[model samples]
Target: MTQHETPERGARLGRACGADGSGTAVGGAVVLLPGRPGMPLLSPGPVRALVRELARAGGPDGLATHVVQHADGCPERAVDEVVRRYGDVPVCLAGYGSGGLTALRGGGHPAVNSVLALAPCLPDEKASAPPEPVKHLAGRQVLIVHGTNDGRADPESSFRLAARAKKANRSTCRFEVHSDGHRLREHRSEVVALAVDFVLGSVMGGRWSRPVTDALAAPPPLGLRMPLASGFGRSLRG
Candidate 1:
């Protein structure tokens, strides 16, 4: 794994990536939230690869990235720190497992233009409590990528969340990695490529592909159950 320098200020750092140093015109930043509140910067294989790949794909521009080692026990709160760190740039909040739910919760932040959830693991409602909030996502884009064969988090639950999110924000869309597991090991390349596309488009601003656009307009489960093929980086984008 490669090493990164820590900025002098803002949020406890983990892998401050790309043009984090002065004089680099950072157009946007993608903050990665791990499944847990904190972990060693690059210990987790998936998180490591994500930060590396996204940064590499983004090149040395406005696509700087950082990992939140400790979310103050709240991913939503972590976003506020991210905004302070990135300054004047659109932010894409992405998370894994339960952290994905955290990213969804944090999407309401004004600086966040988009939210991405990978194998989100949401907790069961208390039955007395209200459902997850979707209203706050009104203008922001949201994408949920779940593995159909995920053993940890129920894929259906994410679909339900996506449906509500889609209703609140017509820009919401989802993709299912057929037969993949929680780690999404089987299609890591495709998943990372697709994620890079989504985050970059959301941060730098770009049009969605026809399939994504169609899903955005499709009803209920149709949009929430869109398939993510092995070559989706190219095929789905078309």
Candidate 2:
């Protein structure tokens, strides 16, 4: 840990690996943002595995991780926590579910090279709007990976986010849909492999393209958009 760096519980950083153990420290960093019902970073086993993958893949030294209080705290607090610890490092923001919501809310981090979200949750245009349009994330680079079978957050939301990013002129914003669910515990290796490819490619300036478009075109759950939150309706009425 760097001097004056405050660590989140279980927060530590190391290298990320490539096949055959040949990897370079591209000064890349990755932070995992937890989803709503805001579980600790350790609740899901995959996150730990992700960290281990980075170590094996040759990630930079001492990356910082943070746990926000559900989605209640200001997004700036999260960004500040990360910046305070890892200065000017190439950072990737990742979150699952509402954790993605919170991570997106944070802006103005010049060091963030990209964002990786899985099964992200978006507040209906009701509770509040994102500080910037979802497409703003594409201004840099973003990788959105969601399972087609996610019931809590239909994949369409992720598609809308991807479209927004494209509208923002982000050519590198890629979205991939897997045949799994919200947790991704079902298609663990497949999901992780895609994520690894995304991170490595994004950092190394490799050829970029949308990972899955046909899947993104798939229909959303029937009647899923009908139940608008009453607060959202009120906000519009106001």
Candidate 3:
């Protein structure tokens, strides 16, 4: 892994690139962005797991992984800097929370082929609106994974985004994990696996076979189906 810090428009931009073990140039790159007050790029457990999964799937000639850490709060600008630096290399974007929203916003970039947004923080009517309009997402393969029980960021927002993307005829998929919360720490392994599969298959030309899609469509087993706790339960008992 090679680390570099360059000044971009008065803000310090930090990026780390991990080359495939083959020591050969890879055609595609996966750019992982951190959420607000971004941590050291790729330091997060989920991000590291995704990178490891990518390596295992693609082997030594697979896509190179690049993580961008933002110095300021402007995630959009951070993504722009990465786009400028990467130039023509086909890039896939992935992030969590606010960073995931930023990745969605950045998906329209001509250089970005696909996006994986994990529990993205969607724009609220009272707060700031989305950085980019839904129309900008046309023609991109987008995969959004959000927990239905998330309190910090509503999962419905992801559904809305998917709806808009679908209306625009873009290829989009939404996976809702029932009973999972904001952090989604309990479902990290499943989330990382789906994310890696989506990034590789959708962005890097890997096969998005039926089995993969089937697995993604299936809900996690964490959700519980219980009998009603009130009159319904009493009626059943009666």
Candidate 4:
């Protein structure tokens, strides 16, 4: 794990080198925004797995990965800080749950080339004011993966976001895991592969081929029910 020069807010940053044993500063960077009340910069479940998969893929030469933790749950500010720290390198934004929402919000930053959001927790239009992120996401290449059976954050929210992005003419994609829940541990491998492909393709100028696109759009088998595993629950308290 590597540490960055401390930011003004004293937020801790963690880094992992590329899998090819390439030096840390060469390839594109992926900045992971943590979920609510973010304590651990890197979570232990699917998020961790995704990071590992990306590292193994060895993005361009440098391919450094980073996670920024925010105690106040201010993911927007965290993203800005990461952008400042990384300078001119291409950066892909990603997050889960509340962090996913933040990633969507931060995707509009000029420094962020792409975004990967998993089960993003979007604000309810009826409950409160519309989210600020929705306004800034136009023209971004965004991919959202949500579980149809997600209880903590409704899958409808993702559907709604997709509709809005389409209306705004953003390059966006959405995938639904039929029987999966919020954490989506059962589809962990698929999620990691999809995220890596989307991010790498965006940063490396690779095409989003038909096979990958089809796999992402394909729905889960009918009545498929994968048993919930430990550490797969969405902790409301964060």
Candidate 5:
């Protein structure tokens, strides 16, 4: 456990289960935006596991974790709150499903070092289609991690996000396709490991883009031997 610093101004504070109570400021400050409204910040179990895993792997000293719980369609509101609190020091948006939509939209902030959107939900009704927020993430360091077998947001969404990001002058955008579902329960540990490595590398080393041969290379999850199709989805929303 470490100590907490009450910034001189702008602080949106809230707590949930598994919040990494060490109170110590690890590698810079990180603002973790959970799922949108109606969806809890820490989704009960597996997602919490994912978070804990990231916090553990993030660094040797451990990083600070803050969760933003806002309503649906109010990601902008949460983004403002995050700006108020963290104030441009490498904000990490960790959202799932539509929450990922919220995270990407929040990227306009200058302090945002990178984004980790998992199974990001596109505004499109079609599962295979990309979301509307894909266009808003230009010039930002974004890592779209999706599951090949995802049923909710579809596996191709990551591809769409990556393609749009790449086209938008952000060549460093990364996409990690895994072999799991919307929740990524099968590769929970690997997900966090990637998240930690990416965040640390981005903040300290300014490295966010993952090396990829082809945008749609089929690979296993992070570490597991699960046969899966991994690649950036096609951008359908423009």
Candidate 6:
């Protein structure tokens, strides 16, 4: 894996790490983002582990994986950089915490194929207010995974956003990690594995699991309310 940081005239310098340390990919590229600026979310944590695992699982054709650090506390700029990096290659946006919100916000990028938001920090809008604008994700697939007991960012807020997103994009889905917190470290393996499945199938030509398909196709609240059960990890392995 190779790492690099170049100064950009207007944007913050994004520290990027690649899976193979070179070249583009036919299987496509994934851009992982952190919630806050300077947080090592792109380092040797669950997201990084997911990047490594995805590279290994992407077959001989290989997948290009990148960790885009939010050096300026703006993950969308990181996404923008990754989109520019991959050009026509489909890009999957995966982000954690505040970065998750960034991924959803960046789903409108023309090059984006899918978005995986792991416990996003969404704005708490009043019930009477208009839903967040999600028309941009009209043709894109979106998956939101939030912890039921998330303290830092209210789980309800994400659910509301997901509901709104589902309306705009029928392919939108959300998974609830029961009793987990904002970090979702309790079931990190399960969460990461789910993310991998979503990215592979959505960004590349990989097969989509039955569960994923059902969630995306199901009507409204059902898909948005799907639970990441204890057996979920086993199901993915199977």
User: TM-score for each prediction?
Assistant: 0.86, 0.65, 0.73, 0.75, 0.69, 0.83
Enumerate residue pairs that collide in model 4: 26-62, 27-62, 27-63
Question: Which candidate number would show the highest lDDT if scored against the true structure?
Answer: 1
**Judged by TM-score relative to the true structure, which candidate is superior, 1 or 6?**
1
Q: What lDDT tens digits, residue by residue, belong to model 6 across residues 3-77?
A: 223223234324333433244344466777766666775543367667666766663344566666655444566
Residues 1-238 of candidate 4 have per-residue lDDT tens digits of 2223432332554444352222344446677865776346567436877777677764434565667654454456645555555556566788888888878877877767778888888876675665444656665677788888888888877777766664564466776777778887777776666677777676655655443444334443211112222232123111
The per-residue C-alpha lDDT of model 3 at residue 120 equals 87
Clash counts per candidate, in order, are: 2, 13, 0, 3, 9, 0
By the TM-score metric, which is better: model 2 or model 4? 4
Comparing 2 and 3 by TM-score, which wins? 3
CA-only RMSD, every prediction: 4.4, 11.4, 9.9, 7.7, 8.1, 4.5
For each candidate in the order shown, give its overall lDDT on alpha carbons.
0.75, 0.51, 0.62, 0.63, 0.54, 0.73
Q: Which is better, 1 or 3, measured by lDDT?
A: 1
Name the candidate, 1 or 4, with the larger lDDT value.
1
Of models 3 and 5, which has the larger TM-score? 3
Off by over 4 Å in 4: 1-12, 17-25, 71-73, 76-85, 131-133, 211-238
Q: Predictions ranked by TM-score, top down?
A: 1, 6, 4, 3, 5, 2
The TM-score that candidate 3 achieves is 0.73
Predicted candidate 3 versus true structure: per-residue lDDT over 1-238, tens digit per residue: 2222232332433533454323544556677776666366565437777777766664354466656664443345544554554445567777887778878877777767788888888877454554336676777777778888899998877776766665663366677766677776667766676677677787567766443455334433211111111121122111
Instruction: Candidate 3: give its CA RMSD in angstroms.
Output: 9.9
State model 6's lDDT.
Answer: 0.73
Q: Which stretches of candidate 6 lie over 4 Å from their true place?
A: 1-24, 43-45, 71-85, 126-130, 235-238
Model 5 over residues 1-238: C-alpha lDDT tens digits? 1234443323444542222323444344455655656667688324576566545545334344566665654445544544454343455666777777777777666556667677777665476855455555565556677777778776565565566555553423444445577877776655655555566665545433234222223232322122323322121111
